[model samples]
Target: MTMREIAFSLVAVAGLLATATAKAQAPEPFGRPGASDAKGAIELIDPKVLRVCADPNNLPFSNRAGEGFENKLAQFLAGKLGKDLAYVYYPGATGFIRNTLNAHLCDVVMGMPQGDDVVQPTNPYYRTSYAIVTRAGADLDGLKTLADPRLAQKGRHIGLVANTPPGNVLARLGLLAAVKPYPLVVDTRVDAPGADMIHDLEAGAIDVAILWGPIAGYHVKRSNGRLVETLLTQEPGARMSFRIGMGVRHSDQEWKRELNRLIAQNQREIDRMLADYGVPLIDEAGAPIAVEP
Candidate 1:
């Protein structure tokens, strides 16, 4: 669940893991012999510190520069726990959880889908959707769905990540020719598809793009009011929104409980933080959340 970035797509993560250098020359997985890992023993909890496993270069999520929202969330939680914050850095490309959290290098991973089967997930802290991005004043600015027939018109180049939910919708609509595909797996160390998609949209290389909400939000905010991102909540067929939470080992029930409590107690603050980053939050009814989360 490098995302659920918080990649709502298991396909994307698997693609990255399959393509990255995780398979060859990768060491045998290592962690404390008696620790909670494949053996499922009790995890070693350092009550004095919060160690997080994060991609060193992913932004609007986490990065070594401490600018991503997950970095800020980690800092906030560590303060709430009265613990020092620490990080175990790696590219999120492949074998990330296996090398870090599963190896006992870190205790938590922010931005996972709530019910993902890999790591035990915490209570959802926020919910977001994939979104459509376009130039602020452009004709596609108010676009709400891939089913929009306007999309089939000539000259509407779409920059979409391959194999995503919206991609499916587009395919069903027979608008494949409109798409200028973006890759599912790239070196997050130096390449960001979301940013690149937004850049292309801005530079008119592509007239439209569909991307994860958080990624779209962050870049759009930095675009000097030149872009707009509309939530895909109204789309049909493909599920576009999901709840996001943190991840820990299954054996860490107490840890999960504590995190759940923190989430419950400070959800409003968390909402504000995500909103500041421009994340497109949704509610249970699949509507855009009110300004107040």
Candidate 2:
């Protein structure tokens, strides 16, 4: 063969080898369903869909129309990732994490409290304080906060949902005598009617109620301005606010890291969402006492 022909053959072989190498190094498509990559903002596979588990009837958190604060956050995440939002609804009851997210039925939980709970939380998106909800037109003028000594006075029954951190906190503070325990009826579907407790409150069966911020806020709003007076409490340890965050499966470290980044970048928007839902702005300690109007 001529020298030129030999040289040409060698060049062609080298070009073919380079092409093959480049193709091999390219990233494989994302394995999970509904993953995406939006212009390199985050490394996601195409056709991304964020499968979020949420409650269908719970308000100020999530609902069927995706109107809740967490629902909006999920939508925002989907938009940030350039993916579609898919929801799996289950009442936010007990065993939700284990039965749903842990079971791999959904990829994320919208509002898991940050702590050593069933699932791990990403960075907190919003903070809220426990508020004291009372019957409409009731006098909270002297209450000031949960630490008010008047709460321990006779005839003032504090209604608390059963088996929650607040209930436990109340017990630790030596306030259990003043508390009227209402079996937790949400999420667990324990055959107890939450409305019964509320009814009892309306009938003057209970003078006060201590519930989580979201639930309290929701009840106050739904009362149509009738259930008046919410006092921000300063009960010891009650001052410690629970940080609600998104939860991912324990094995999803990569996904969790990505979610934390997204939360950090959009903290302001998240705060606004919580507020728009009537979730009171809380301090680091989670008490709703001194939030600016």
Candidate 3:
């Protein structure tokens, strides 16, 4: 959950990260492929199998059990493409893209920020934002951002991932002292901080949790009326929203286009799937889309 919420921390931690840097303003070193390249490199991908690189334990995204939304999406795509599905399981820590896609162990990444430099992204399928999760009907249910004056009130504690954009806004609001910070990176195989945060909130350890939208959405849906999640739209200094797309190696232009076609043809089904999983999807104008409570 560091900054962009995926791969940014991995890029830094891997040290060998040549791309995936936070320079979104810069053009992608590998631009989108033209229709001609689609025919040129179509052979690089297997015609009979759909391969995916994924974290073995990252919930709401992927897991070894094929229970996460991304896992479901991969299965759906594979069915549509008339191919058997395969997975390259990695820790999603450092070298996620390297050990999986670059090593030729997999063909696609199910979900990541649209403009990642290391991978050529297909058309974005969904958008989400950072959100605040709280116990239902609590006084803090009205929370919109960390900068809200109610957060500065006595005994009000906010839980957030350290080094994320929301953390920066809290610091500027002089609310850092009252924040319960979670680690930005950890062994996902053993830790689930977002779930832990929800547990703590229910147990009254913190008043609220500011989490990535997918994480918040999934957990809130499971909370069964005990908790409520809402997107944060009031923060000015931090970038709170992002669009997610499938990622492929930079050389796999034709594969990228194929994925894009799948995305275009299945967008309605994709939106419904994401909503069922409690993903807080939004449109380009910052308006919500296919989002469920």
Clashes of each: 3, 9, 0
Better of 1 and 3 by TM-score: 1
Alpha-carbon local distance difference test for all models: 0.72, 0.56, 0.72
Instruction: Write out the backbone clash pairs for model 3.
Output: none
lDDT of 2 at 128: 57
What TM-score would each prediction reach against the true structure?
0.87, 0.71, 0.86
The digit string of per-residue lDDT tens for model 1 on 1-293 reads 13333243522331211112132123323334444342223454455678898877777787788987888999999999888999998776557767777777788888776556567789888877777888988888678878887899998899988867787788789888999998776677777777777778889999888887787877788888998888887566677777778878666777888899999999889988888878778888877776674
Which candidate number maximizes lDDT?
A: 1
Q: How big is the positional error of residue 36 in model 1, measured in Å on the Cα after superposition?
A: 14
| Cα misplacement distance, residue 259 of candidate 2 (Å) | 1.5
Off by over 4 Å in 2: 1-47, 168-178, 185-203, 228-233, 237-240, 285-293
Leading candidate by TM-score: 1
Whole-structure CA lDDT of model 2: 0.56
lDDT of 3 by residue, 1-293 (tens): 44344445322211001122232332223432222333434534456778888777777777899988889999999999888999988766655676667666777878767657667788889877778998998898777767778889999988877666677788778889999977666666786677778889999999998887888888899888999988975587777776778877777766777889989998989999989978878888878874433
Q: Residue-wise lDDT of candidate 2 within 1-293, one digit each (tens)? A: 22222211111110100000011111122344444455432322223678887766555556688776778888988999778988777655444555556555677877654553345568877665455767766754445466667776767788775554455556666688888876443332222223455567678888876655665665566777756545344555533344556766655667789899999997777776666656666657544534333
Error of 3 at 165 (Å): 1.0
Better of 1 and 2 by TM-score: 1
